[model samples]
Target chain A: MRLIGKEEIENIAIGAALLGTGGGGDPYIGKLMAIQAVEENGPIRLLSLDEVPDDALIVPSAMMGAPTVMVEKIPSGHEALAAFKSLKDFLGQEIYATMPIEAGGVNSLLPLALAAQIGLPVIDADGMGRAFPELQMVTFYLEGASATPMVLSDEKGNSLLLNTIDSVWAERIARSVTVEMGGSVMNAIYPMEGHFVKKASIKNILTLEEEIGRTVREAMKQNINPIEDVLELVGGTALFEGKVTDINRRTEGGFAKGTATIDGLNKNKGSDCRLHFQNEHLLCEVDGKVRCVTPDLIAVVDSETGMPITTEGLRYGARCTVIGIPCDEKWRTEKGIATAGPRYFGYDTDFTPIEQLNAKAGITK
Target chain B: MRLIGKEEIENIAIGAALLGTGGGGDPYIGKLMAIQAVEENGPIRLLSLDEVPDDALIVPSAMMGAPTVMVEKIPSGHEALAAFKSLKDFLGQEIYATMPIEAGGVNSLLPLALAAQIGLPVIDADGMGRAFPELQMVTFYLEGASATPMVLSDEKGNSLLLNTIDSVWAERIARSVTVEMGGSVMNAIYPMEGHFVKKASIKNILTLEEEIGRTVREAMKQNINPIEDVLELVGGTALFEGKVTDINRRTEGGFAKGTATIDGLNKNKGSDCRLHFQNEHLLCEVDGKVRCVTPDLIAVVDSETGMPITTEGLRYGARCTVIGIPCDEKWRTEKGIATAGPRYFGYDTDFTPIEQLNAKAGITK
Candidate 1:
């Protein structure tokens, strides 16, 4: 992977927005943050995880805490860099590079900012292929990776270093510090060598995110349909386009988890679709059939502007198009379903692929 | 803390089940597993973090994956032992003792089983006072603990040692392996020094769980209500009593997340209660006010049996009593709220403690 230019960042944001599947949070802020970082610090090196030397100490950087809070509490832009720098001092070692743990919304663009400012390259991969709510929900923790020696930096410039005995503790302690700091904080964690990254990371995800994000931008700039452009980039299928009719959401389970009922419009009318989101859309049900389930992206985009809206941003009157995109093959196996399927989210349903569901619904056209 | 007797182990399961508040899964199986291990290997010594020698190697052990799956897939009884032994061998050190990562359901008693089986002492403390879904959601993970170099073993005796770059990968890679191994696996992680445990652990949790679990058992044996017994054990408050009238569940985020609507009965009726759960009860709304919220334990128990049923186990027509207990003081901070409040979960309302809500609703009696 190489450095992406200014135009490419905008394209990547657009593509990442579509891939965000309507839950990575507002991309505009992330785009602005990334663009600012690039402008101020110069182009960041986007390194492939494979290209990094084995001895290179890599740290994943991003924001943590409630995304809803992120919208309200704009980052100070110093938290991520501060966290990374503090860890370097604490560990008494020069840092090698950085990467996004997941390529979604602010997090996707966050590392770009951090790496640009710190003069390191963002890796072309992430721990998770898509977005998730919790820090420990990443593939790394399940494989027994560390979230620790983690530093959470609040906007107030207060930094807390945690060396918990487990990942849950990291979340537990970080949550308190984050809330105390105002519900949003920047974090530098999952510090590991290239060997571990190669063993566990979903390779080239940053590149994939960049490709997907870029495709959306280029398509729109050229007067092309974003959904169609996105499909070509990832071989994704446009599942449905609808108007948000009703959203019955309740902040439950320490997450913004609820169901949004959408009126099928513009070819999806006469049919109803339901989106189940917990900070992100986990399940998209259409016409009484399971359409798109998690681990796969379920981004909701503005039908015209092609901008993305997060699950938190979902409203009753929002006109949107629901797109179902296939995740990497790693997310399709039985293990994928176990980690990202509808059942994994609590629905007692069989693991059905988006491709199969589209075929069943005749929506694959 | 020393080894709890076989009698205490039995009692602890009962109390732990009650404290589980209807979502930690069957302690029956965990108890049986612990009992069998204790019977087979005699007894385990219990140790306080303070008692652990500075050089002693301590590894926290628990089941990592879905509780719903754990109920379905009976562990082959050797997974934890395998993970522990693997980890023990990896560092080439004798593990001085074992500890529970969290104190709920099967995971609570898991380390007890391992400790007794290996003749290692059980630590009285745990990472979290209650159960959470993710592996990296622990206080230890926040405090620079490593979940990596973890060994995940399947029943087929296929073991993979993972050294991910971060905690998220641990969750990711382990969840994938678990999905392949059948959605449930035992993991021994966060191998740390005794000094780390002292700083990170909520000490005497097994003792706490046992006392709590035992209180429920003894009260029931004496024909006393388990809820009342629980209240006494932890200075808890009874939030509500009712019969489940509806359950809306969907598994979308690799977690069995949903809501259970309970009809107020017994002491109160003609009112509605909604308890939202994602692995654990995140919110408890009685009538229209928020009665109990996350970070604080909002558990449900059977009205008659007092046995706690998991969120997935809830069904219409089942009678339940809602209990609200305080969480660790650290969770009471603003940061804690950001990590685990109704707002954290996506609700717009502020948190109101169960006691205050109970007082408001005249349920204080």
Candidate 2:
């Protein structure tokens, strides 16, 4: 695990902030909490999933419910630990490690805090590689992991443990609890052996987030395009340099789902591209052929500054560039597409590599 | 396994249809398809979970996607079988049994059809024991079951196998498939052994559905109160009969969520009750106490004919009666309340058993 000091929290938060694109909620809270956790318990140990023992207990921790409600209903903070502890008590075992559920936004920084404070090393990998609504939306769920025997805690310190028959019911019940708890709370779930984590997670995402954060900031200081820096770090590349022209949004299906329209700027003009999002950019199509889709990273950023724009933050008239970065080799597989591709996001297109999409468009590498 | 024939399907559909309470979508298509499947194969065998061996393969058959979409893009009637076949081929094993994911509307009957045609027995239980849209909302999801390795078949003859890392990802990918397939498709998921089915499922739901269906139908013909008959089926009672005075609806989070204002009838006249829905009747707050919630079946039916008024169908000035039935006892546990109680649904009230709630109101069974 790479060692990071006190200042890294702010740096990572800023990097996460940039990648957040506009939503992902204020990274400040996660930053503060993480920093505190780190300060209290020393630096978080960030290990690649590959470093994890196959039989080690690994749990993903995060906040579930309306993010809008999260600000108002301050979490018990202990909810994650409480839930984690309860599960441990139930299983009569101790947790060996922790991991983030999503690698972007508040979630990205949260586990750093959890790991530092709880004295458990956090895996650098994540489930979706991005934020998504619903507790069961993790990659682990698709692989048959349980979100049940989960612990839910409110700000007032009320805690409940559930052992449901399925993840969806966990979501439904948890959603109801979130609403009742005033819309946001803390949760720890998807407890499984480290082997599952290694198999499912995009390994070393925490370090990647830190590097992504550090790279963007360092590049900014050196006047390098942070987008390119991010692309390079994550094996990604720029898809298009453009100005955000229009944004349409509605909170639907438990997510802020919307479309961001971008007008080509550098070489092309009057041509438009559409980016569809559901808490995460699922599909990005330019002039109607799929340009990029998951399990590749499609990040919209500032065309001028190379700052990231989150799924919920796409706005009309914001100058931006869309970048396509490759996910791990696994996401490009048939299993990957079946789980996180364009078709998975409702696009009629087949899964195409971002590089291929760029090549098809005659864009120079 | 108990044998249910053609007449039983007709009878059960009518009863389950009534119990569906509008949000379950119409049972007409499900009944027709199920009847055809049963006719083509044979009467479906109904079995208790205990009737099967521990190793007996039990998979749940369901319709995935929006109810509105289901009506338009009717299954090619091949999707379920195709999905089942995919799983069977993937595992190189034959399935021994089948079950429904829920016991409401089309869900209750569709599995019977699948089971009959596939020459498998239908377990008289389901994960949810009620209709909910998303795949992860099932109790089985909580039981550490994965929806992936599950099969999804579209009308276009595309049978996709998803072996995701988690259940939530299953929904995301499946949802995208549904949208790409033009929304609505059949799926077979939550593959498990019979032992898990017995432990998790609400036992005898098929017979219960049949009885619930029959009780309401016979009540209508016998000139008895259909609402009363429904209440009797689950040891429930009438909360209040009323006229809907107002309805406010908007689709949020991919769900039809809204509120209905009912003018209390008879003894409670001049007072009003508010019913909230998100795909289904989630709660009923009369004169401001959170009266009923999810897990407890709250159905708003026509006063005279006893037809359920669904969330999407609630209209101003509609005459109706609101009935509250205790959900499957599984829902009453702490895990259940945490998963589906009023508090879970965003209400501040503590859970009160329906009978107790009735008794408090001075209403007798």
Candidate 3:
């Protein structure tokens, strides 16, 4: 087991944003809230999946709604804890610990804050090693765990407990409630036994985030190429190094969807890449050919600061480097591909693993 | 206590539609469902408010969303029961009776069917004596009863339990979920003790509906003027007798809003009346003078048959007779006026009781 303090929250925010692949909402407020929670309640204990008892009851949680709205609305800082308490009351069972629904952006830190406030430990693993747009896109859902008996709470002290037939329906109903609760809400879902959490979760995602975050921070401190260090540490390949030339964005069906064009520079001058995103970066195509797609991480980081740039923050003239990392092996299964592959995103091509795509393009790992 | 047989459903439907004031959806399917439930589970018992035990648990329920969508997507006939069951499980108490959230159109019969299926008696009182667009418009809400600990259920077996700060928030949040759950859902709300139900509810609204329906049907059989009989029975006044010359309608924010222009006929020829509505008729003007406003009933019925014409059924060229009836005494109070009067519906004029309006227009009741 490990303990998460003020310093650890900063690293987790940076790492989570990178893994968010441009979605997962802004991590700044989440980081601040988490830091405050830790400061007020001392350090939060983080338990490894293996350390959890078989009978332990764990519930994963996060914020649901438009990230843009979240920045302005700002949570009451008690919505997450309220959702946890309501769920605990409904379940009539002693909740052993809290877990992150996804290891991306703001959601990565929500559970830590909730744990600190409620005097509970947070499990180190997560439902998604990286962020995906919908609630049902988590690995737990892919492995047949239901997201029902879920609790959604808002800043106004309003809460709802949902019992849905399946994970997809859970997403549909909860989303409607989220929109109604002023366009955002905190949710505690996927209540399960420790055995199920161990089997269905993407293991050690918090540790992965810390490592990725530390690698970039150290590289920047030493005045080395932070992008290259990030790529090497994650076994990812550099897709592009360029200045953003154009960006087009709009909200459609409750999601931020847009495209960004980057003109390559330095060693790869004259070439350009296009990134298409819906909440998260879904695909990357260089020149004309598709280089990477969803289920693989497509992270955009500042060339100088090494800070991850979310889709909501994309703007013209930002010099950045894009990297493609392979997803967890569990997401490469047939079910995973069916759940979040290129076709699921309305793309015509089949999902080609990020590493395979890089190797085919003659980019050495 | 009284027992309602299958034969009584038709009268109830007719009366409920009249009280709907051109909203509350169609009562045909609801009538059929109620009759079927009665046949399947024996006659449903109807308990008067005074007969209810003080400690008995009472739950009021109804269908919410676009009435237009309900015609296309017929329920699986189990959604209401599902909502009741879920609420029952959550409360973990012995529910003694069911009640209608409103005595208008489809909702009037929902509680009867639920009572028959669950072997519980249905109270003759309802939250609303007449239908209004929002859930919080009910008399229970105006009287300070909370609509929380409510359950919303869809035909697909998805259920949500809401615990909100107040009745208005419950409506706001539940309406969003209803829209998301394919534009309609069944909800069981306002779980209260029998004593509270007696104090907060619009008493004997169901019996009033039955009386009005029977009077109209008997007048039609006897070849008497049914509209005049309806006016006399409800102590209402004949506001206008005309043919619909123009009708404009659209759905906004989940409620059907529209206006109808009527050209006066017979002795009233050479004049015109305009009826404005949002779900239910909220205002009426004759020769550009305000004749009636919400909190008072504005019902339009087929001229020859005395059958209420719902907002959904209003079309150009339909010959109709409009009537204005006084609202329940409770609705004329300060708090009641604030809840569902002209101002609440965004009308510029203050609420004028139907009797005063009729007297000023020289229309004797």
For model 2, the superposed segments whose C-alpha errors exceed 4 Å read A1-365, B142-144, B164-169, B268-270, B348-350
What fraction of correct interface contacts does each candidate retain? Answer: 0.00, 0.00, 0.98
DockQ of 2: 0.03
Report candidate 2's fraction of native contacts: 0.00
- Where does model 3 exceed 4 Å of error? A268-270, B268-270
Evaluated with TM-score, which candidate comes out highest?
3
Cα lDDT tens digits for candidate 1, A21-110: 666666777888888988998888888777888888889987887777887877766777678877786567888888888767788888
The CAPRI class of candidate 2 is: incorrect
lDDT tens readout by residue for model 3, B1-365: 88898767778889999998988878897787789889999999988999998988899878888877877776655787788787888889878889898867788987888788878899999987889888888888877889989998888888899999998899898988888888888888899998888898988888888888888888888877788777877878778889999989987777788899999995652379899999899899999988988899999999998999998788889999888888888889888899999888788899989888877887765
DockQ ranking, high to low: 3, 2, 1
The residue-by-residue lDDT of candidate 2 on B1-365, one tens digit each, is 67988878877776665556556677777788788887888787888777888888888888876778777776656677777886786566789888888766678888888777767888878787676666776777766677766776677665555545567666765666556555677787888887787787777777877887676677777877777667667666567778888988998766788889998776653378888887778787878766666777787778987766677667888888887877777767776677566666566777787767666666666
Best lDDT goes to which candidate?
3
Ranking by TM-score: 3, 2, 1
On TM-score, the stronger of 2 and 3 is 3
lDDT by residue (B1-365, candidate 1, tens digit) is: 66576798887786676556555667777888888888888877887777899888988888877776776776765666777776776678998888888767787888888787767888888887777666666777766677776766655454545555566556655665566566777787888888888887776777777777666676677887767766777777777788888899888767667888888885453378898887788888877778778777877787876677777678889988888887776556665565556775666778766667668767664
**Second chain TM-score, each model:** 0.90, 0.91, 0.96
